[model samples]
Every structure is written in C-alpha cells, then in structure tokens.
Target: MRDAPLEFVTAMAAHGDVTRHDADGEPVYMLHRPDLARHVLKENGAAYTKDRTPDDDMLRPLLGNGLLTSNGAEWAAQRRMCAPAFRPAEVDRFDRVIVEAAEHLVAHWDGGRPVRVDHDLTSLTLTVIVKAMLGTDIGVAGEGFGRAVDAVNRFIGHYVPSDDPDPADTAARYAGFHRARTFLDRVTRVIIAARRAGGAGDDLLGAMLAEGHTMSDADLRDQVLTIIMAGHETTAKSLTWTLYLLDRNPEAARAVHAEIDEVLEGRSPTAADLPRLRRCRQAVQEAMRLYPPVWLISRRGTADDVLDGYDVPAGSLVCVSPWVLHRDPRYWAEPDAYRPERFDPDRAARLLSHQYLPFGGGPRICVGRHFALVEATLVLAVILRGLRMELVAGFPVEPEALVTLRPRHGLMMIPRPR
Candidate 1:
C-alpha cells in the first residue's frame, strides 16, 4: 500500500481504457480512460451521486453535510446558497488579500537556506484562504490549524485500510479524527459566533452571515469547516507539485518566469492579469495533470448503468483517476514529459474534449476552481518575482497518497535571490 497508487493505476491504464479491481472482495471499477470518465462525469452524472459510504463515513464527522461530502437535496441547497460567494465579482474581491498574504510569506522566506517548499506553499495558501474567505488573522491561528490538519491526514491515512477494523485501532482513529475536527470546529464556531454578534466586519464570512442562508448553527458550522478543510490543502498541494515540476524542468521554469516578468513586471497580479499569466497557468495545469491532489474522484451509481461496454450495477463504486487519464497516450503525446506548451491555446484546442479532469468535470465540478486558479497564479507570480529555486541534492520527493496527494518526503529545495 506504500507504493503510489497512481503509478499502479497508470500502468493498468496502459493496458486498457478501464479496469476493475476488488477491494476486500468487493468489485470496484477504475475509469482511467478519458471517454469513459466523461460519460460518467458529464453524460450520466445525474444518475450517479457523490455518495460513497467509506468516504462519507470517514469524512462526515469532520465535514458534516457540506457540499464536498453531502448528497441529494442537501447538497443542492448548500450549493445554491454558496454559489454566489464564488462568482466572478466575489472571487475578484479576494485578489488583494491573496497578494498580501503571498507578500507576507515571501518576506519571511530565507532564500539562502534549504526550505521545504511543500510546507511553505501550504502555509502560504492556508493564510490566503483564511484571509480571503473568513477574513481571519490566520497567521495567528495558523500553527494550531496546521497541526490539526496534519493530525487529520495522519488519522485518515491509518483509517483507510482494507482489513477488518481492530477495536483498538478504530478507537484510536476516532479519537484522532474527532480531535482534529473539534479543533477546527472551535475555530469555525468562534468566527460564526462573532458574525452573529455583528463582529464579522466586511468579509466573506460576514456576507455569509448577512445572507442568512444557513439558518441553523449546525449548517453554518458544517459549511465553514468544509471550506477550510477542502480548499486549503488541495490548493497547497497543487502549488507544491507545480514548484517541484518547475524545479526539475528549468526550461519550463524559465519560460514561466519570463512570462511573469513580461506580463506583470513589478505590479502584483490581479484577476485581469490572469489572461497574461497563461504560461504560468499552463505550467500549473500540467503539474495538476501529473499530480492532481484529488487524484481519484469516487462516486456511486444510484441506478444500474452501462458505461463503455461495462455493466455497473447500482451501488457500485466507480473511481475516475485523473492521474491516469491525464497521462493516457491516447490523449497525450509523451505523457510523462513536462511540457506546459501542450496547454497553449492553439495546441490545447487539438486535444480531445474531456481529456483533462484536473478539477473533475460536469455539475459537480469544483466550485472553487476559478478562485484556486487566481490564487495559484497570483502566488506563483509573487514567488517568481523575487526568488529562484533549485532542487535539493538527492532529496527523494516521492508521492504519498492521502486524502490528497502530497510529497512522501517534504519538498526541500534551495532558494536563491533572483
């Protein structure tokens, strides 16, 4: 199980478009083929739901019935209520906050010292998310929050096992998971309570309070916790992998820095600058293709369905692995190579539709997609503007599959003055 699951999935993908595996004698289908994924994600999405028992059971206590783990009417209601907050205008409002956080992060980096890029990116992204979404001083809350997140990941890693659960292990896992959740919940509740007492003071949380969409304290708690847990780690992991790829491929890194230099010059990046940061965005896209933090998106069929000549019974578990599909030779050329140019507009147009599932697809696609792109591009621009990085000698950056894909060993790199 220590072996990277993406590697196994990619190898299997080379043999067939889709493959089936048995987990604890329960049949599960892995959809690595792009067309098949599209069929399930796009065409037949409504017939399926994001309701998987093991995942839901594991995450439910932490996320509650929030959008990431909720299903049916509950999901629809929350999605409708929360969708406005991620609109173009609202997301654009986050630009300055994101840049400010990035600037603060850059100010603290010791350029001459070897640093764990993954840890740095995670800290930076978490700060941005907290400021932009919650309007909280996460720099103050960051240490405890980071520890809780790490504990949650460690708990999930141990808990997601195939063997029949041991009572002791089960009890320990529950304790760890709930402890993390309780810590996050305390942070979330304090914010919510402040908002209720009219102290939110002109931020997303304040806006959410004004809307009054979440009437129940339980609902608000779940939504706030969901965003904090779901948004921060995924975006951080994406940036970590992007930097890792760039460090190994200097040519691509050079192109990215050049694009940033030419496009934004000394000015901080904004939503308007996103179009000019096309190369930067492409590099991040390619990185996500290679290492999508949400590598495998699992769903369950609500009814019997036939997909690409395979019968999928109702209640069947279907996993669509972007890590495999993104590297399929049928859709990509030299799939293993780091080539951001493939995503250039003219070149990208030639690729098959639905070939890329970096953020999944269809109605259930990531709502924070635009927000993430803007944040990552802005942060990348800020980081490149003042610093250059080199991979640390002989540091093995292996992939660790957890709730998200992270470096098995932290990403250590040498940063130098630009």
Candidate 2:
C-alpha cells in the first residue's frame, strides 16, 4: 500500500475485484466492482462519507470549504448555488469564450516544434475556464496557475507514509503551498472585486454576485480556486490523453478529422454543432475510459452494512477507482484498446449506468461534468482543424496519479500543419 503510490491503481488490479489493506490497524477496502462502486458512491451513498483522512487534510487548506472538500449542509449549499452555472444550457452560452481561448492557444503555439501537449492544454483549458466562469482573461498569467497547481500536487504526491516528515521538508512543502495559494488567492480576490465594481453580468461569478449570494472572504476564495482549478486540470489532461491516443491510431485520427470536417465544414463550431459531432464525442468518451482525469474516489463507511452482500464495517475506507473499473473485462470488451466506436450512441446507451463513471455518479457527481464535455469536444474540434498532433518517438507516457491523472513529465508531441 505504501511502496507504489504511482502504481496504486494498476497494482490493485493484481488483486481480485475487492482487496483489503491494513491502514495502521484498521482495514481499508478497495472495491473494483462497478456495482459496489455504485452502491458506495450513489445507491447507498448515505452510508458513506468522504474519507476524512490525512490525505484530505492536505487539500483542505488549499481548497478551504469549497464544494469539492466540504460535506453535509455546507457542500449542499455550495453545490446548489453553483449548479445553475454549470448546467448544459448555461455552458452552451459560453461557446464564444471556449472558442476564443482555443484561438488564443493557437496564436501562442510555436508552430512545427515539439510542444509539451500536457502543459499547452493546461494553459488552454485554464484560459477557457477562467474566461467562461469569471469572464476574465488569463493574459500574461504566464502559466503560473498551472505551475502552482503542479507544485502543490507534487507535494501531495509524496503519499508515502512518514512517522513524521523531516521538519525542514515539511516547512518547505508548507512554504511552497503557501506561495501557490497566495497567487491563486490574489487572482480570486481580483475577480471578486471586479465583479463587485462592475455591477454584474452573466459569468458564473457575476451571476452569483447578481443573485446576492454571499460568502465569507475565505469561502469565496475557495470557491473561485475550486471552480477554476477543478475545471482546468481535468479537461486539460483529458485533451492531452485524447491526442496521445489518437496519435497512436492513425485510422481513428483520420476518422475524428473526417467527422470534424464534415460537421464543422471549415467554420468555427458552436454549441449547436456539438450534438452533430458524434465521432468527436465518442472519441472523448473512449479517451476518458482509458484515462479518466479523476481516476480514484474513496468514501469512508458511516455504518456497518452489506454492499453487494459483502460486509463493509463502519469507519472502513472504501475506494472506487474508475481507472480499474473502466478497464475491467467484465464491463468492457477489449478494454485496453482505443476503440471510440464502443461509445457510438446505440452502444453507449446500452451500457449500465454504474459501469461508465468517467465523471463519477450519484448525488455528489462532479459539478463541472457537463462543462468539461462541452469544453473538451470544442477544443478537439478547433485544434484538429489546423494541426495534427503526434507524439515524439520514444517519449515516455508515464501515468502519474496526482490530484488528477497526469502524464508524469508532461506529454511531448509535435503539432504538424494539417
């Protein structure tokens, strides 16, 4: 359990559907079965709560009481208030912002050079999320926000056990996190202030302000950071992996491009165009199946109960890793292969609700799920129109399980003119 933090997801596969680990003296259950995963995350959700372990404590300071970390009435309130902004209808209205950000990324790309696809997409998604959610540009932010996120995640990646970390090392990590949070805090405060001064508009932040929703200074900062970082990192990594997979399979790439050409017709796409881009959506779905950004989720059992007829003791931590479940032979045929057609409308509709959880399930499902799909689909359509990205030969794609599933050293790829 302690030795292979990066391989935790894959290592669990060597065990059967359910395996138990001794955390201190207590037993923690890692359930790979989709049915039990659904039971824990959705069906009998009340029987469990977010595991309030030290790992989560590490994020509380950075995230505060935002929706991602908060529980009970607090989480409910924040989720309800923000839900309006992330709904499909609302996300559709932000099409212009999404396209504009994609355009901005193209302008900055060093054409025909080997670009760090992961870092580039991080910048692109960060820009899109900021503009859509806050109605602001990240101009000259110089990829600082993404760097800050990486710094904190790298610190957290030291998921290794310690009787106590070296005092100096602890201090360094805390200091580093402080610097990153300070930057995000400053950015969030500016957004809040700008919204206040300018009256109000339809941006998510402005809409909240317009509705007279209020929070303490700290809570607002947390919400701002949560909205931006959560939306930014997941969508970026999904795009990076999608491109990586497409590069490895030219047939699929050609199909994706043909669909893009047919549906978009050499014009910039809109929210209306998204519904007709079936192949584009299928590719994104299959990509998510292969490398879901939020790869692992866990909840501590609140009561002694039976899940799928197995005893789940009260207070035991139960993990549901989508990484394993998506690859489970039980739910998928040729799970490891990149087969976008597996998600064609008829087949996708036939999949069991519990089996496909790229965005998670049940009440506390990701708030930005709709926004992410819309954003990812649009980014792929626009980017493929002008460039064909290929992985540099021999570039290692190491899957690092951080706050999101990231390619450890960043995905290096070359963008050739289409």
lDDT, candidate 2, 78-170, per-residue tens: 898899899899999989888877876766664788888888888889888888888777777747888888887877655545665577877
Pairs in steric clash, model 1: none
Evaluate residue 98 in candidate 1 and report its C-alpha lDDT on the 0 to 100 scale: 85
Q: On residues 1-418, what C-alpha lDDT tens digit does candidate 1 reach at each position? A: 2345767777667667667877756777778777788878888888888776455755776788888888878787778866777777888888888888788777777657888788777778788777777777665677778878887886765434555357787778779878887888898898788668856456556666766754578878888888887778888898888888998899999999899889888778887888889988998888888888877777888999987788889988888887777877777889899898998899888877568877788777888888888888888888888788778899998888777888988898887878
Q: Which segments of model 1 are wrong by more than 4 Å?
A: 1-4, 158-174, 199-203, 211-214
- Native-structure RMSD, model 2: 1.9
Per-residue lDDT for 96 in model 1? 88
Using lDDT as the measure, the top candidate is 2
Off by over 4 Å in 2: 51-55, 164-171, 211-214
Candidate 2 accuracy as lDDT: 0.82
Output the lDDT of residue 371, model 2. Answer: 95
